[model samples]
Target: MASEPQYRALFLGAGPQMQCGVGQFTRLLGEWIEKAEPGSCTTLTLTRSEGSFTEIWGAVGSARSVVCNFPIVAWKRVMFTPLLAMAMARLRRRKTVLIQHEWAGLHWLRRITYIPALLLANTIVMFSPLVRRELAEDSLVGWTAKKCVLAPLPPNIEAPAGMAASDLRRRLVAARQDGRLVIGHFGSIYPAKQPNALLEIGAILKQRGLRPLIVYVGSFIRGTDNVEEEFHARATELGIADDVIVSGFVASDHEVFGLFGAVDGFCYPLDEGLTARRSSVLACVQAGRPLIVTGPALPDEFDHHARFKELIDRGAIVLVPRGSSADAYADGIVAALKRPPVQAAFDFDGWWQDVANAVRAQL
Candidate 1:
């Protein structure tokens, strides 16, 4: 047999060397494709320029198609490595796909660098109308608009098998038994994520004569502004520092979901409101606990994510207005905990299949 191309596609990714969610997404997607089609895709994890070119180009050369998810937030050294490989693939006449995970939220200078990748990709996939709208606002990538198509962002984390929610719940039972509410916030802690909202809400909960324990299942992003320092400083100011817990980076999905299981309910008052791009929220909803999230700025936010929409329709998730006061958020938090626990029927596997099929169609 001729060894023309061992894999159906070459998936370029920035590995989990930093605080990037795309890294997790890239790995999960590669695993799913392999399961779905047997010998379908090869995932090449890139870290900066060290041995990236030869390996990425070799993978690109071996496969029938190329797919890359761009904008590895926080790690700029290897940011454009995938695009360079895509250019090489195009030179060899291979069709290239770009998964645009972010844009509007990035700095203007960073958005400028996306121009080359936008032009190099044969097909550009966006996860939401909001992202498409953001991309369209910039005339730099205007020509690639026709090549753009919308896709769904499935949860980055799946509930680990055999991880009993009952066992996990026992860990937090002592605090709850003492009349304390555990309010969980998932994903990288940063100002954009409004982690301070957790502290604020916890303070408000205290003000209303209730005990609140704020738990961050993820860690703070150490960036240019000393994010971790500020988070603790603000917590100190609010006088809830002792009540807060930061789990740092938990590597195990079982542990992550276990923490999810331990919480009374989850809350995220995102600065940008709810949208299709918050993979953490997607993961948290699968815990089957009540979730209080801010309403999306756009009405058609969930158009591409029908599964999420269905969950919202079924009352498994609650959405308060974007600028609701801390008192209001506190009220929603208390109310969400009181709501009967209804396991969400969020067809996670089905969502992944839809996303995979949509993307493979372009390939």
Candidate 2:
């Protein structure tokens, strides 16, 4: 009789373009698996194209053992996902795992593609309680109640503690010494992110006798789209174009941290459309920087000063309601910037380890 195939673990959504929380979580999970099981387990990454595929393959090759699973596609069309799933099913034995992210949809016809994999998977990892609720509501897990596990998202990169609080304070003071209050925003540039709202807030700050220097770091997510162009135009219209510095995509975490260090405060003015926890907020917490967030109100748990609740409280972070006018957001930013800095300790490493252990438990 033929011997049964060796049990190998597959990470379904590992790609180079995957830069969000889900990607970070999957990569760290793979690393932990290597450390825990050594050569006994393997990670299978699905890629979209061949170009630069070798680079990613090499990066992951350092793993104790991993495999690259690429599906050729005529375009970015997702029709290939079903075929890929079918192929994966054939290659899979023992048990496989499937990790779901925000975009995992559940249309009846569309569900046909990944439904088989979901049913066959020994474990399914979900990133948030919201995701778990969605899955439970859909009843997509079938009778495999034991297979689902809630795993919190992971940070993209480990945060570095390079600047002391005194040094950071000095940098902020220096930036403000020239009569301009340096307010920084970092993250992807997109309409849903509400970059234009920052420009409007700058105008409001100017009206309040505060000269605002706005700095945006990070490249536009979808290219030179109309939304970004309009955002720039709004700044120009406000006559604060010179005060606004659009630093397109700083690669170094230190450089990003320096920007945070230099700024009086950080602003995140996302619209109500976004639902995921803000990674930028996590970065701010790790960097020990205060924030001026304008959008849907954060949960009450974020209101406490030491705990996660305090991070989102109106006391710690200035919260503006979603759809609030640019002027209202600007007023909130000015008020937040004027408040004295509050020192708080955050355990980023501990957070990652806890999340990793949760994923390990399910595996």
Please report the candidate that would top TM-score against the real structure.
1
Lowest lDDT block of 10, candidate 1: 162-171
Question: Across residues 271-299, which tens digit of lDDT does each residue of candidate 2 receive?
Answer: 54223345566676555556767544334
- The prediction achieving the highest lDDT against the true structure is 1
Least lDDT summed over 10 consecutive residues: which range in candidate 2?
Answer: 65-74
Q: Runs in model 1 with CA error above 4 Å? A: 1-7, 14-20, 45-56, 71-74, 108-113, 142-145, 164-171
Error of 1 at 158 (Å): 1.1
TM-score of 2: 0.69
Clashing pairs in 1: none
Q: Which RMSD values do the candidates have, in order?
A: 3.2, 6.8
Per-residue lDDT value at 247 in model 2: 73
- In candidate 2, which residue ranges exceed 4 Å CA deviation? 1-8, 12-25, 33-41, 45-87, 90-96, 104-149, 163-174, 223-225, 273-276, 295-307, 313-316
TM-score (all chains, Cα) for each model: 0.88, 0.69
